[model samples]
Target: MNASDSPRPSALDWLVEAARVRDAEGLHRTLAPRRADDGVLNLASNDYLGLSTDPRVIAGAIEAVQTWGAGATASRLVTGTTALHAALERELAEFLGTASALVFSSGYLANVGVITALMGRGDLIVSDGGAHASLIDGCRLSRARVVVVDRGDHEAVRTALRERTEDRAMVVTDSVYSIDGAVAPVAELYAAAREHGALIVVDEAHALGVRGRGGRGVVDELGLSGAVDLIVTAVLSKSFGSQGGLVAGPTTLRDHLVDRARSFIFDTGLAPAAVGAARAALGVLRAEPDLCDRVRENARRLATACGAETPSAAVVSLIIGEPAAALEVARRCLADGVAVGCFRPPSVPPGTSRIRLTVRADLGAKELDRVAAVVTRARTAVAATDAVRR
Candidate 1:
């Protein structure tokens, strides 16, 4: 057929087809913003300390806006760097016991920056199989030879490192696995990396405000302060109850990142309000280190109540083993005025559908009891549905 005679699919056609595929698999995703006064109990968010709505944090953001304006007008390389950013960096480095720190717009960008900047085409990157999506993306973007070891396998990491033919090697892992809420064997992995002359990068997203002294993170908790070659990233939106991310390492490494990391050089700097709120949150953490104990206690309590019936950690994931059932349970919890997370195929490994509930320090006894009741009810409903299907 002639070029003019041939039918061409419109640009929107692909989107429609994609939506249809998602609908068929019940995998379609949608965003529903929560109202400021929503009465629903939240067990889905990553705000472990529940400081997102704290008066101090809000006041800090307000003060920052008044002093430094709303948005960063340009990238950090241009006009985005402010006194607040510098202060946050300094305070963060001191808190984490790192030699230097570089703030990024988000945790995802921080990972992208670290991995790609440090490892090039000839280098090798050995990562945990269960590392966060951001780290996986960073490895792909780095153009490095990426090898994913078994989840929490220190020996596999060592083997991978030993087998590496590249001149430079790096090992990456999360201190806490986001989905299962299981902690990684960071000390063993670090030792293995050291033995092989490979640098270690730990993402302490979930461990930052939940582990270590004054929530200094897993590195501090393990007494590996300033020992690991590099610690890549964390989301301020989580425990900090703000926005932005950070990379902490040696002064020379950070200086190299500032010059080479594309994500830091090209992206806009963190907004003043986020920096201020994070700073305030860090100050609060320093003052009330007991917040860490409360969060840990809440998690342990939930895990104990669930017993061997549910998966562990601050994140108590109830496996349904079926996507539709998991979704239904999540819906039931929501209808009962408790919001919990539903993880299916793409998010979880295939066939590991689960309802992931994250515990927070702000969850009072009454709220915890309510959540327990709702989850039990949801579980009963799923069991009944399964029985009927059989």
Candidate 2:
């Protein structure tokens, strides 16, 4: 081997360096899969309505699998469009009060498709600083000039909208932030966008089955259904307990995305089983509206017991400051037979490491008490470790 080849580092060396940095900073994360037979108290999952394991939902999935087999088999533009896909789109549109709706394989793909298809070079996108990473990546792909405004600053959004040079502009934000569970001022934001002739896009990933009357999401909650200009996108993975995404909007916009959105046009359509499961979940939501309230109450109880502020939605994150401490707290809770989420930098905004907890309608009072006790012990342990270091 040549001397240069022996001394020089490979491209994979950069990955090793990154891993080393993460290890030193306590930012490294790994997945620990739970066995199907293992029984543990779960406050970590996004199944807010607890529909993933519901009998009706499972039955629907089974039926679909029996009829349609496994995969969609092709892209929707080609041979993948099925009757189930059409039915799900129609039902979602009717439920959300939109003129039309289109489904994507995942929420991430839906965001990428919408942003890239609607906006282009010379277009302007005014996004909230707290918008999810998918939205941020979509902006990058759109080749639009992205102006990130302060979180929930309506007046600042208005000013930016008014000052935009591009004839095409869009305002994007989440209805409920996934990390802190804070509700966005959607009514004010949409009004500002309308005044400036800009389209508004709201991602209701966390709000779909957790907000509004009958869980129709923020638009329905605010009674701004057809009045909002552009569209709404959401994940089926959360409260819907399925694996897909959908964009609800005017028929013209839906058609535009169908034709131009690379994510939709190129990617395989959602599985038939997922479509069926989501439809079943929607039916369940219609029959039992109080499930939403129960999830909200569970969230309130946990936050109250922890002496933390009650989250505005189903996600209640206890901000633990430092990353190492947050991880330690999560570990202790796991050891205590409680499974909770630990979110650190990159997943959350810088300096806001937290143990993010999602409340489920299925969690009873006894379960809540156990969770509270474990969290209390975890918090005390973290505090004592910090005191020792000082």
Q: Each candidate: what lDDT?
A: 0.87, 0.91
Which structure among the candidates has the greatest lDDT? 2
Worst 10 residues of 2 by lDDT: 2-11
Question: Model 1: how far is 130 from its true place, Å?
Answer: 0.9
Q: Which stretches of candidate 1 lie over 4 Å from their true place?
A: 1-7, 308-313
Mind giving the per-residue lDDT tens digits that candidate 2 earns over 88-118?
A: 9999999898989999999999998999999
Model 1 agreement with the true structure over 192-235: per-residue lDDT tens digits: 99999999889988888888898888888889988857574677
Model 2 off-target regions past 4 Å? 1-8
Model 2: pairs clashing at backbone N, Cα or C within 3 Å: none
Worst 10 residues of 1 by lDDT: 304-313
